[model samples]
Every structure is written in C-alpha cells, then in structure tokens.
Target: MTRTGSPAGVLSIKPFRRLWIALSLSSFGDWLSILALTALAGSLTKGSAENYAIGGVLVAKLLPALIFGPLAGAVADRFDRRITMVVADIMRFALFLSIPLVGRLDWLYIATFLIEVVTLFWIPAKEATVPNLVPKDQLERANQISLTSTYGSAPVAAATFSVLALISKVLFSQPQQQANLALYINAVTFLVSAATIFSLREIPKQRGKVSVPSILKQIVAGWKFVGSTPLVRGLTIGILGAFAAGGAVIGIAKVYVKQLGGGDAAYGVVFGMVFVGMAAGMFLAPRILQEFSRRRLFGLGIIGAGVALALIGIIPNLVIVALLTALCGAGAGIAWVIGYTLIGLEVEDSVRGRTWAFLQSLVRVVLLLVVASVPFIAGVVGNHRLHLPGKNIYRFDGPNAVLLIAAVVAVIVGLVAYRHMDDRRGIPLIRDFVAALRGEHYTLEESTREHGVFIALEGGEGAGKTTQARLLSIWLRDQGFDVVMTREPGSTKMGMRLRALLLDKESSGLSSRAETLLYAADRAQHVAEVIQPALRRGAIVVTDRYIDSSLAYQGSGRELKVGEIAEVNRWATNGLVPDLTIILDVPSDIGLTRFASPADRIESEPREFHERVRRGFRALADAEPHRYLVIDGTQSQPDITRKIHDRVRAILPDPVPPSAEDETSTMPAIRD
Candidate 1:
C-alpha cells in the first residue's frame, strides 16, 4: 500500500529471484510452443480449414483448465508446492518433446492438452507459494516481477521462433518440418525449469488432512466469496472479459495476418508487440499511477484496452494493427496486475489458493470458448465487398467484424465492473484521474477516523515531547474531551520489549536497518493494539513520538533514505496519518542537556546525528504546514503547555456546558 518505493525491491529476495528465473524460462518455452503449434496447425490444413485447425490447437491448450482448475488448487493446498511445480515442469518437458517427434495433428492436440493439464497444477502452486516467499508489503512487487517475467519473454520467444523457422526452411525439405526446431528448444526450456524448481527448498509443503469433498467445499466457498465480494466479482468479470478479447485476437491473428498479405514473421511481430506492450505497462503502472484508486484503475484499464481493440478492428495497415495491439496489451496488463494485487491483499491466505483456482478456471473456460468460436466466426463471415459510386470497394471481413463485436462486449464489461466495484463512487472520475496524474491524490482507503482525532508529538531526543503530550491530554480531558494518552515504543505489551531493546545502551551494536525495523514493529503493534481502538471510539488520541521519529532518527540521523523509512512505516501503520503533528524544536546540544539519566542508545549519538534528526523534523513540518506545528522547545513549561492547548482546541469536539453536565449527572453517558 505504500507508494514511496519501487516494485523491483522484491527481487532482492533469493528464493523469489530463483523462482522468477524458472518462470521466465518456462514462459519462454510456452510462448515458443504457441507459435510453433499454431504455425504447424496452419501448415497441415488448406485455406478454409486453417482457421479451424489453429483454433483447435489453441482450444486444446485451454480445455484442461475447465476440468482441472479447482482440482489443481486443491492439490496445491494439500501437497508440497515445490514438488508440484517440479513434477509439472518435468511432465511438460516430456509432452513438448513428444509433440515434435510424433509429427501428427492428433498427437499435437493431445500433447497440448496434456501440457495444459500439468500447467493447471503448476500455476496454482506457484501463485499460492508466492505470498509465502516475500514480506506481505512486498507481495505486489513480487507479482509485478513474476507477471512481467511470464509475458516479457514473449518477444524473445517470437524472435527465436522466427530464427528457427528460417533454419528449418534451409535445413529441411517440408513445410511441416519448419516448427520442429522451436518445439525441441521449447522442450529443453521446461527441463531447465524443472531443475530450477527442484533446487528450491524454500517453497512450503502443505500440511493437514485433504480429500475430494474438502477440495470441492473449498472451491464452492471460493466461488461464494467471489460472488459476495464486489471487488473480487468486478475483478473476475473484468479479467475474464479482457482475456476474452485477447483470446479472440489470438484465435484469428494468423488468418488476419494472411489477409493483410503478411507471412509468419509478420504474425510473430504482431504477437511479440502485444507482450512488449504488456511488459511496458506492468513496469510503468505502479510508478505512474500509484495515486489512482486501484479498483477504478482496473476498470479503466479494461476500457482503454477495448478502445484500442476497436481501433485495431477498424485499422487496415499491419503496422497500425501492431501498434494498436500493443496499446491494447498495455491496458490489459495494467488491469491484470492490479486485479492480482488486490486479490492477494484482500483475500485470506487460507482460501487464496481456491480463490485463484476459481478465477483461473473461469478465465480459461472463457478463453477457450472465445478462442474456439472467434476463428470459426471469422471463417463463416469470410470476406465481403461493397461497391461505391466512384469505383471504390469496401471490404468487410469476418476477423474485423468479430473483433468489433468483441471490443463492444469488452467495453460493456469494463463499465459494469467499474460501477459495481468502485470504491470512490461519488468522486468524479475525471477529477480523481487528474489528481492522480498530479501525484497529490489521497490514495488510502476512506479514513474511519471521522469520529476521533489523532495527534502526535515528534521531535529530537529530550525535546520535551513526552511532557507536552502529557500536558495536552490532561487539558483535553479537563474540558470533558475523551483523551487517550500513549507513546510509541512502549505503548503496548509488544512495544515495551521493542522499546527496551531499542533504547538500551547495551544494544548499541544493532545495525541501523535493524533498529529502524524494530521501531516500525513497535509502532505497528502500538497502533493496532492501543491507538486505533481508542481512536475508533471517538477519543482524542495523543501519541508521543510517532512515524516522524523514525523518519528523523533512522532516516536522516542514520543517513538512510527518508523515502525508504517512510515506506516501511506507511505499510506498518496501514497508512494511518495523524490529524496533527506537533514538533518541539530545539538545538541538539540543548535538548540532550535536559536528560538527567544516563543517555539511551539513540540519545547517546553524536551531536551531528541529533542535528540531522532536528533538521529532518523541521523539513517534514515545512513540507506539510497544514498538518504540522513547530513550537520552540526552549519556551517556559506553562507557555509550551498553553501553545499545545490552543492548537489541540481546533480539532477537539464541542465542550459540554456545565448545565448540560449537571442535567445528565445521573444518566449513563452515551459515547459514539
């Protein structure tokens, strides 16, 4: 949820990095196989039957998902994920190798079907295992990388297929032989994938009882959850619709290319461009659109893709078609990434596998129907010519007409999904979009802090923040304000231990990053256990030393990047920002002199460190004047107390009159 960091940060995890490598190799093979199989299918049939044969091959690849999708997730849930992935990869390698060796159309479909069945199990296991591989905060980044690897290799595969095709033409006597080289190479990639997966010991093994009924129950529960959750429902519909349009394009791409007077290479470029666009979109989306509502963005992405698809249907030039295909890919890619991220963030881990499986199953079924039917529809419509007055002829073909219809359907689905799941329904779409572009949008979920007020006192060590927080809470309580006074690093039970570890001089050897993480851990537990509950019940919660302490101390004082520190704390607190932050400004030497006891680990830092911390606090206040107050810490105690009281009064609830309090003296207090 933190928008302060890059998605590439997850790649630093070794296990995930290795898994990403394996996925890349496997995806390369899958893309190459698609090209080889479709080309071979076209070669084996005549003009009219070519479309059907290609559709049949594609259908064979998707059909297993309908039968094995839920079962695959169950298997992933009930078995060892590492073993499942390795076994699936090995089977796929054998099946792929057999495709080239058999040299029969029936064998081709059979092998493709078997490969897809293996893939069904592989995909769920991978998706389920990914959440366990990285920190919860890094899951989105991990998905971005994994998905990018999944499709980013398509361009490379297309180029490889083209090169292999030329090699076969020079090396063989028959057109059927042209695809053999690519298929054989594809088989090798799977073997490499299997080896990579087999070596990964990090993937957790599933434990506990498992059975057919349990699996079925889980599947049913997943579906029920999907239906009940508007976010999931919209994501499901949007993703399926997007893929349906994509499948239609894939089904007729070969024939469409032929109609444009293009050969296999042209088709390969067209295919490659789509994924190129996908990779670009996935890479750019998080960076550029982080401010937008993710739910709304998912729908908009689908709509954008549909518009691009419609343009593709109307455009005549192959170059233009390729460009539009890339644009379509970009929109779909954004939707795809956002959809998966939302699921991971919102769905419980216990049911995540089944949820993913249910969605995958539905998506595959939709793709199969669209892919199988679109090419046939194109063939039926064939080509038509209409004469105009000035010897001009307009041609309307099946591919064009089918694409146009699919585009319209996709657009409608996007609109419905957007409206159904829109979190910012009342906010104007254009206004929110413009704000997002300016990077000033409030991207957090609507705040539940309506009834309560949150205030934090932050400053360098020994700057009297604790004293000020105490005085302010006392003042608010005297005025009949429900005030909860707390301090981070010691507010809750868990935070107390962290506070001891952090402030003890004996722990001086702790690394700066470790110290920062410890503070964040304390703050997270404090917010969840102490602060949030008090705030929810309409209390004016006053906290001493919140997020700004970390940003100032670990970030600037320890010379760590402020943005990185902010990102960690933002996720830790679930984007909970205090309504007001008061910084008691004082010079480091003067502030340190106020401490009577032996200096703690942080307080004992050199003058330069504390100076940097002070500067950090001032900089933060300067940047957000509306949310911050900087008071001179050297002021008289009563003057400082009065200054804090004046600011606190602005956010406090209306004070109860003496007459009203006397009238309700015997009655039970009704709190919001």
Candidate 2:
C-alpha cells in the first residue's frame, strides 16, 4: 500500500527528495518561530491587553489565505512555481529577522501578516510540485509522508516550546526580548527554505503566452473544470466542509480546555492530545481507505471532528473534553492529506500550481470565516443569546458555544459524506482482486441469477465500443438478468486515474508511448484485481473492452507492439483474459464523427494514428475470436444492445426462472 519510490512503487524522484528535505526544515523553522512568538506574547504585555494582541496577531497570520490565496495561485500558474516559494520564503525570512530590531507591537502584526502572505504562495508552490515528482499510484503515500511532517513536528515542537519558554523566563527580566531572538532563528529557516527551493532546478511550465486575461481565464477555467468533473467536485466539496468545521473547533478550543480543569498548563496537554490524535488519525487513513466500504476520508474526518468537538462542549469533564479535542485534531490531519492527495491526483501540471492555490485559498477562506466568528459567538453565549437543541447555551467567556456548534455540524456532515461519497483508494485492492480473480465481494443472493447477469464494458477510444458496452450491459441486466455494470480504463481507482490521463483531450501529444506501460500496469491491477473475480461468482461478466484497450491504445496507438503489451500485462495478471470481448467495429470516419469537440488528449491524435488504433483493436478482437465478438456500432442503440444480449445468452445459459416469474407480464410496480 505504501507507494514510495523504490523497487515496488514510483514516487521517489530526485527533485522530490530535495523538496521533502527542504519542506522538513521549513516545518521545523515554522515551529521554532511560533514557539518564540507565543513565549514573547506571554511576557511582553502586562495583562489581558497581551492576549488580545496575540489573538490579533493570530488573526493576521490567517489573512493571507483569505485575502491573497487566489493572487498567489495566479502567480504560481503564470510564472515559475519554484521561484514563487523561494520568493515567499525570502520575504518571510527578511520580515522575521527584522522583528527583533523593531521590537514593537506594530512590528509583530506586520511580521505576522507578511509571513501569512508568504505562506499563501509557499503552500501552493509546494503542493503543485507533487504530481510531477512521481506516478499517480504513489500519490497517497507521498501525501502521507508530507502530512507526517506536520504531525511529527507538532509533538516535538510543543515540548521544545515549553522548554525554551522556561529557559527564556529564567535568563531575562524581559523574557519577550529573549524569545524575540528566536525570530531570527525563524528567519534563518525561511532563508534555508528559499535556498532549497532555488536548488530544485527547472521544471516544465504550461506552454502558452501569459497575459492578464489568460491568467484570469486560467483560474476561472480551472474552477470550471472542477465544476464539470463530478469526481473532482464531490471530493473537493467534501474536503471543504470538513476543513470549515475543524477551523471553528480550533478557534473555540481554548475555552473548552480551560473549563476542563487545567489552567495555562492545559494548553500543552490539549494541543499534545490533538497532535497525537491527528497523527494517529492520519496513520489510520490509508488502512481505512484500503479496507473499508467506500467513502471520502476528508468528509469522514470532518464528521469525526464535528462529533468530537460537540462532545467536548457538552461533556463537562476535562479528561473527556481532552479526548474529544484529540479526535478533532486527528480529523483535521486526515482531512489535509485526503484533500491534498485529491488535488495532486486530479489536476494537470501546467495549471497544477494555480489549482493548488485555488484549493488552499478556498480552505483558508473557510478557516478564516470560522475563526472570525469565534469571539463573536463567545460574546453571544456570554450575553445569553446563543442556544442549541437539547443542550446548554454556552456563555461567550470561552469556546464552548463554538465547540458545540462544530460538533453538531461534524455529525451532520459525516452522515452526508457517508451517504453520498464512495471511497477512492490509490488502488482498489480488494475490488480489483475480486473482479480479476472472479469472486463475489459480498454474499451472492440465490435469486439474483433469475434477474440479470453482471457485465462490465471495457475498451479503447475510437474503437466505437462504449455505447455498445453500455447497451449490452443494460440489455443483459434488463432481460431478467441481475446486471452490475462498469467499464475500463475503469470505474475503479487505478482505472479511473488511467482513464483521466489516457482519454484527456487536453493531454494530447504529451504522454510518452512508453508510458503506455503505466496504462497497462493499471489494467493488470484491474484484471487481477477486478474482472475474473466477478466471473467466478456467477457474474456473466460482459465488458465493452478489457485488456484489449491497452493492447490497442498503448500497443498499436503508441507503437509498443501488441505482444509486448500482452507480455507485461500478462506478468501483471498472469495472463488473465476476459470471458468475452465485444469489440464495436467502425470505419474511422464514423468513429471520428462521434467525438463532437475532439478536446481530449488521446482523441485528438492524428487521423492516421487513430485509424491504426482502430485497426489495432479490430485485429485484437479478430485474433481472439473465442473471446472477442465484433459488433457494428453504427447501428441504433436498441439494435446494438440486442446483438450484445444475443452473444451473452449464447455463452451463459439462464438459470431456472421462478414458478410465476415467466408468467408475470404484469408491471408488478417494479421500476428496473
């Protein structure tokens, strides 16, 4: 399951290695600076004035994400992304170093705001670099490693901050001044982050002229693309929801903690709980994804957090509240990995930075809004205006009202997430195994055989087969056959990813033919992982096309010879072939006419090349007559389906119908 670049997986790139090291150093520096600032704030001001100032500084830090996330995103897309981070880090470095010299309250706010703005660019710049670093299959692991940095840093930093604050308190009368020196150390980290970015070397950028209109258009275009892609949209929204609630909970945590029992010491214990909980949550994420029923982890995280926070607010006991805080913390950590992993998987390289920035900005905005509402809510509860159903209305002195609110929202959101979304693993290990090995994932009902035969459609583009497969799958399901349906470059995780790259019109002329091996690699996983298993369990599996598509597209379309594709694919699956392949035959013109926009990467290939791919698929079908049934796709939908059903019935004899089943010409109030 771990896909780090090595003998087994593909994400370990040289540039990624350097970037990871740089990121670790940057994270360490970030921790050091934060501790320094917290200590300084603790000692600098005499009373409540200092807390307000500290809070103000914290608000300022969050502003960049709210105010300039889009602007930063635009810059990353239009210019060198690596340079963007370098510049952001450099900017922060200079500001932090200057902090000690200024030593005034005003300087603190200025430094905080500037550091935040720098973060706006830094986050997107680093996130955008991920896809280029490794193969899609390893993205989850890459994200895990990236996330582990924050999780790993938090616990260590908490301890470090406590120790450093103690030392500062002992050494200087003006302890804030002693902590002030730590800002210089933070500055050094920023410098190192910038230098490390500078060392990343050149990476390819999107090819085209960059203009104001183009940049704006590109940003809008990215959003449009997101809206249009259901997979992308569903996952993004789920992530956004979880992040928003997590933000509000974090905002209200202080009040919730103080009420529990500990005073100032409670801060470390609670934060430590969060760090530990989230790290543990993050660690569980991959396993849950691998083994559980499908659902988005991000949304799950949100719901988990929401429920946890609400419990903290309602639970009065400090120990339980601490545990709840940990739950909330863990949710936040898991959500980050899932959301970032989604972004890395879905977007293209050219606009990757902008897309990342857009998402960063989006989450930041959500966080900012949640944070801003905290004190206001506290005031309301304090004034006796706020109340929730079946629970006490928390007073505004602290975070209880807000924490309760977050918890309720989390449960609602978690339910929504579970009900709507499906799990998207990096690899659909179990389903793929079932499909490939011909086994039933769930218990097969005895009566299912009397209804429909499950069949999956698979094939290459321009093979004129998707419609045929769809028609066949429907006809089979409708003929009192219990049909479950799917297609390939697949409905599964590994398959969907390959499909995005393979059929993407915008990706034309970019992917290497040798890279067809990746497509084949995905298929091998699909087959050994998906197809045969379904067949073994009495599923009369009918596919539009299966391994045949890779053999055609990667083999002939990319010129990797059909046999080599077969061999590697064979190695991938031990030579598993589909029980039946219904290849929809088409003259190149008829097939070409089917694509109205011709906007996809693969579909836009030169005419002769497509013609050859068309020929290649036909030949593959012809070569495997026992498995492949060539059909005329130019026929009407009903006619095509009829032909497919005919082939299915010819191969798999129907099971005995129930006594009244055949006699029931009645509508039976059943909608198929």
- Among all candidates shown, the one with the greatest TM-score: 1
Model 1 lDDT-worst window of ten:
207-216
Pairs that clash in candidate 1? none
Q: What is the C-alpha RMSD of each candidate to the true structure, in Å?
A: 16.9, 15.0
Error of 2 at 644 (Å): 23
Give the poorly placed runs of model 2, Cα more than 4 Å off. Answer: 1-19, 31-54, 65-94, 97-103, 118-152, 166-185, 191-233, 254-269, 272-275, 296-298, 316-319, 333-357, 383-396, 422-446, 449-672
TM-score of each: 0.60, 0.55
Cα lDDT computed for each candidate against the true fold: 0.81, 0.61
Q: List model 1 lDDT by residue over 1-672, tens digit each.
A: 201125558887999889998999988998998998998888778877888989999999877766676677689888898999999999999998998788999999998999998998888788887888899888988887787687678899988877787778799888788778888999999999999989889888974423223334545666875764455678788988998888898998887777787766777888888887887777797568656766787888899989998998887789999999888888888888888767764444556778886776566667888998987788788888879789987677988888887898889889988876565534578877887778756445536445678999998888899888888888788888888999978988888898899999999789999999999999999888888888888788999989999988886678675657777888888778888899998888899999888988888889878877787776566434446878888888897787777777776765553356568786544332
Q: Model 2: per-residue lDDT, tens digit, 1-672?
A: 111124333335777777877788788777666556544554456533443444555577777555575676666677777777888888988888877777777777788788887776677667778766766777767777787775587667666555554555577566456665456767887798788878877544532322222333444655754553333465566666777777765554544554455533355456667788877777775454442322345566777787777777767777777777778888877766665655554344446676665565576667777767666766555523458788856444446666777677667766565444442223344454353234222221333123334443433455456666666666666665555465656667878887787777666555565466766766676655566566456565655555667766665566554445655665675545454566666666667777666447666666666655665665454322335556666667777667666766765544543444557755233222
